[model samples]
Target: MKTGSTYLQFLAAAALAGQVVSAETIAQINGNKYLSPYNGKNVTNVNGLVTAKGPSGIWIRSTAPDSDERSSESVYVFDRNFGKNLTVGDVIQLNGTVTEYRSSKAYVYLTEIINPKLVQKISSGSAATPRVIGKDTLSPPNKAFSALDNGDVFGVPNNVSLISVSNPTLVPRNYGMDFWESLSGELVTVKSAHALTKPNNYGDTWVVGDWKVTGLNSRGGLTTVDKDANPEAIIIGSPLDGSKNPAITRVGDTLGDITGIVSYSFGYYTILPLTALNVVKAIEPRLPPPTTLISSGDCSGLTVGSYNVENLWAGSAHLVNISDHIVNYLRSPNLIFVQEIQDNNGETNDAVVTANLTLTTLTSAISSIGGPEYEFVEIDPVDDKDGGAPGGNIRQAYLYNPDILQLRKPNFGASTEANEVLPGPELKYNPGRIDPQNPAWTASRKPLVAEFETLDGKNSFFTINVHFGSKGGSSSIEGDARPPVNGGVEDRQEQMELTANFVADILAEDKNANIIVAGDFNEFAFVEPLENFLAISNLRDMDEAANIPQLERYTYLFDMNSQELDHMYISQALKPKAQYEHVHINTWVTLAEQISDHDPSVAKLNVCKK
Candidate 1:
């Protein structure tokens, strides 16, 4: 694809980096194809039959390798057409020219497809349109059937977006799939629909209700009849062919493409000769912008990032957009932590509500990130909110890189001091969680803690994150404020003190152990109890290391000014010089209105022993 000196220089540099391959050699490509140039000449215009195609390129196993070892033969393929026609058992006698890439790898710049039998032409097939009901439409199964009797829900949706069938022509259905799986979502031109709907820009007519999901060569959506949770059975795949998969799609509406037809038997929905997806058409789906975030890209750098989870409900719908937004920044950072995650509440029509936070929702959101190498960790607060927006009183949470922070110890139970303070006539949780013994023992939201074998040291430090009593005022907003009896600001202060004491106790056992207490304190820098407690003790507030003007010390922005309510305090040990730093105080300003009442407080410093 190059045409000049600039291109030649690029090729020379790539050669230096050991990526440029201007040679005649034989190496294993995609499956086992050869990479030798035509007639020993470094040829770029080599053409051939498509043995296979994939995201990695095409598969063209060298026919010249030792007959016994296929892998040894090498899978030759072209960078541009390698992954084409990729599928699980798709083999063909491809006649494409061989080429080398990166190093000694073989590839094909496929010229023609020797085997076009991959397609199962819908022989001017005319299938009956299934019946539709309610605002939602139901239809006949993709393939014919005696009767589809399942739970209350059965039949594909009548979405006008992707399932177009109108008098006017529509764009070719762009299904990201391969030639291998005939059942995978695809697009075939039907001469005319017995019945039609509206039309989209791409000559796509909305096939309301249901139409036959033909192309029986690949996967079928049916399943082995069963009464259990089965994603494999429910998968019809949105194909990103429609207005792209809705970022806020339901938990059950997953994006998938199978290679074979699915079938149900013995009361269970199942796949006949089960076929999972192996390749996706490289075509990008067309979709709209998410509700909040606008244009997105890798956040500044990949170290750490932030999100509101559409009000902290981890299960909140439409988080997919935010997910893709965050992935842009995931290449780095061995760890990630989030705030405002709420649990799933069945009482509400929408199980994933943003008003409150939950563990299940957040865990699910993070797990969807897609890289197997990435692991997850989170703290489930015993008490979410009292009941309103934050009715459960859900606290802030943290997630770390297990690869970087191996868990040494984790404490979810309250300390002995807490158990003793209760009973003795002070049943604080009265009509609700009246423990009678330890009213204060209930974990409304305890700071998440873990001992990580920090990458910089032998012994690990206790990393703790918390979202103290909500609401801003000194006492009015405090859930730990006044209980009428012997509880007031003093009791609230004691709760915080109790948590701090626990940390001190932990360090006392191993004085050399480093510790980090980070999160929204709810209390400002001027609060006597808040500042004195942390200052009176030897603990060091990370603000000192910031070295920025006091004006920049704040983390919570109100009106036009920011507040110091959010804090990150590290041990005094790494003060003078801790290697890297990117607290980048003004980063939140870029957030503008989408900003949470709370601002993100980040620090990039590795603590060490003097």
Candidate 2:
């Protein structure tokens, strides 16, 4: 070991030779902005206590925390082999270069120390108590995600700017991202953690702590309303100690408490736990009873159901669960609007476009379960033309109980043919595709429209089943984009415009036409596309007409919010008698227990003339 004077002389000589030996405080390196101040600069003699260790690296927190809340006092040291011998509570001194790391352009950068030249354990057994996150200590902001975003994270015109390039100053008290950034790499404890979503495939789970939150729904999950996206929730990533997180987590399940290091990964701020988390209080299984709005078994009214079976085919294993959901949970409605019915080959891409075998399997399954022996109608799309799983050729179809209704003018339209409304206020071809060749519907599912008449032929109604373009390429709510890109919004908007025009033509011929449009729109009810559709068609959302609470109107759960992507709309003449209910067969269950990603909905309406 060299003497202090000798070491000083050596350091001086190294600096003179262009080797940097500058020392930096963790706070100074972190800075007050999104990016680090000392990034790409060599740092020496950085002292901190090893608060946590993981497979890839170790987290060190400064013993002398600064008064400024904008600067973090901790940072990750990226070196898998260097941290293998290190343990928590070991005070260590390291020399490295500060760097800002991100997995992709869509994610915010994480301030870290990389290319470590030296790591020396100065002492052992030093205790570093984690800061508890609660009412008194470091409560996360509940409403907004970023101050950079004006008010809503889901606003339109996304990808306008990136947070990393701007590197705005931190506002920890007002924004959730800033608050989490303030604690990056620091060990913190979350109390009374309730799961916001089920564990994903990698066993990562999102949870909300006991704090003030907005859009709290009846099921204890946060909801995405007009402006709030529940920014207080955080995801619990894989444990730092190389242990698996609980895989059977469900929304609203209590996790008791979790102690972990705050880090950024995969487009969201994550908390990598020091160890595995246990289910402290499991929520009771919410197996909703069958819908109460059953068919009246007459011509006065009809009960209709809408469900997205999630790319189902004749041989799909989920067929049983889906049939159970429709027969038992939805109470066997008079008509069912189903989307994502794959061709008979089930993603084989053999140029076969028919789904006859697929529908027969489902209708047979329903009858086997002691339900209605339904008749199905659909216009198959050109192979691989619709957007879905590449070979699936997914499309929408209608399943109607022949005992209650029949197609009035049963002329099935071809794949590329466009349906029209004639002078009789009737579909030119029953079970026809609407604007199938429109550019707005390029590589997307087309709308399936049909006119139905009661058995007595005294009452007639029309229905349109649509599965619009998906939000596939959308950015994350907490991503760098200000408003976050809602993928396929333009195409979906145009598709809605075309469909609304068709509805307009029908209403032009008959002002009091009884029409119901329902399916997996793959959009929020409050967003521009659906809102524009409702405005143009003069249709009322069934959820609103039925007086469903705003918080209870969700049919899907994603990220931190329970949202509605599936909807049912009725013309003004049918709104007064509409009654709706969302059967939570999928969303309320664990990921393993769910048959599909979306919940099904039922609506009862009077189709007969009043």
Candidate 3:
């Protein structure tokens, strides 16, 4: 055997022979910081109450806890060849060597006891009561991780620095992660918890305890606002009891009192419940009434709606519901920027590159509801070139009421043709692609620029429908990289700059050129991409022009934050007459019950002016 292995075996033998140094409690084993004090030592006669057990080992908690909040009172006893039956609540003493085992080099090391020599069950029937947490007990610090995050601020810079390397000291009461770290491995209870979002694929749901929270929405969720705090929330992970959680859960679904042991894994602080959670109250989501516009009755102004239908296909389950939302909830806007329209064959892997069925079915459904029978125009992308679901052939299309507006097709371009905004308030290829061959747009959706003339025959304005690079491939918020490297950030920045340059080209011809650029940019308003547009093009966000509440300006729900991945921007000429509202028919509802991932937004603008 190796010298190190032999020395460890010798120490084990000496420990079994009663030649032990001294008995230490579980608290002494778990020191305050990342490293344990007795990490590589052979200790014996440590006593604890068996609180939880698994196939490989059992977690034992000291009946008496140390006053130091930094040290945990519970420790895991690892057993390789397990044949013993140690039940919960059994007071036991074990002789083992303290060891820190890291699953991998990237993962954090767990302080535990390896190769337990002698486990003596001393007594049974001693109940270990859980500590109840609520307003009076342990309160969570409002916010997800720590202020020492990638950016000392949350949701700002992407992947500039790393938190693991910073290794900021644990501030339990100040940061949410540190708060949970302080109570690691201890049994606790959260009273009157509600689901913060839908249960994830693994049957885990983020929830908030019964206490005050920042950015509290009407549906009992914390909106992702710039200046809000939600410290009383946590994640209820998969039940350790092996029961499956419900496949779907909506926001505001009341989860009765939860009792679990605190633990950390896969980034977030998770609570491993001993038993499955039962839904005590399920809140039925309510859809808002159709948006009404108190505008010019002559239709000189148009209501434009933008929606990312999340790869919509003709026979998808949510097709009819999506149509209803477009007609009823969005009030049959004059111009609709429809994104993610799948081909005729849906996701079927074939050379079929048309979306006539998808668009026609939607228009026919609107006519059925007494809404306008809209005529659509679009350019199908080259087969498998656009990045999306394989064979989906998803592309952006414009659904306009031909009665109110006319497509300015002085010239039209093919699907692969590049559209450049030139002087004379014209497009080189009307309804054409924007810089398709640019490396920044490779495997990304190209913008569709179309010039529109109001039916009044007195006005013309330009609109660009763009679906920029998505936020996929981005690093996790709790990743090792500081600033949590947001993937595609560079691509998105380039895409926005290109789009802004196109807008600038229009302004170069007519300083008062009325321009409306709208669609799923797949970026938040405050990010660098949108910020770049503000700096270069001097555009105004419709959300700001309409005076929408800062916290409520979101159309998508991702992770624990209700954010905006869909947006609308107006040029200087069209800013004064802009009125916008995000119709919350989809994003605010349960995932299973919603029709689209993005909530469509309707904006009213006067195209006749300027």
**TM-scores of the models, in the given order?**
0.39, 0.95, 0.88
Ranking by TM-score: 2, 3, 1
Q: Where does candidate 2 have its weakest 10-residue lDDT segment?
A: 1-10
lDDT of 3 by residue, 269-362 (tens): 5788887777798877455656775335334567888988888888777777878888778888888999999988788989999899989988
Supply the global lDDT for candidate 3.
0.75
For every candidate structure, what is the RMSD over all alpha carbons to the true structure, in angstroms? Answer: 25.9, 4.9, 4.6
What TM-score does candidate 1 get on C-alpha atoms? Answer: 0.39
Superior by lDDT: candidate 1 or candidate 2: 2
The positional error of residue 388 in candidate 1, measured at the CA in angstroms, is 7.0
Residue pairs with clashing backbones, model 2: none
- Tens-digit lDDT track of model 1 for 1-610: 1135664455445434432222221222222211122321222222222332333334332323333221222233434333443443343333232222221011112111111122221122223121121111222233221111122111111111111011111111211000101111111111111111111122221121123433211111111111111111122222221222222221112223222122111121212212222212211121212222121112121133233233455444545533443443233244445555555552343433332234444434555775213344453334433222444334344555544554543323322212111222111211111121233333334445545554444544556555554542221110111110111234335446755665566455555556666665655544444655575445776666656444445434321123455666666654454322223222222232232444343455454343
Report lDDT (CA) for all predictions: 0.32, 0.86, 0.75
Q: Which stretches of candidate 1 lie over 4 Å from their true place?
A: 1-310, 317-332, 346-374, 383-393, 409-444, 454-457, 472-492, 579-595, 608-610
Alpha-carbon deviation at 6 in model 3, angstroms: 22
Give the per-residue Cα lDDT of candidate 3 at 582.
86
Q: CA shift at 82, candidate 3, in angstroms?
A: 5.4
User: Model 3 RMSD to the real structure?
Assistant: 4.6
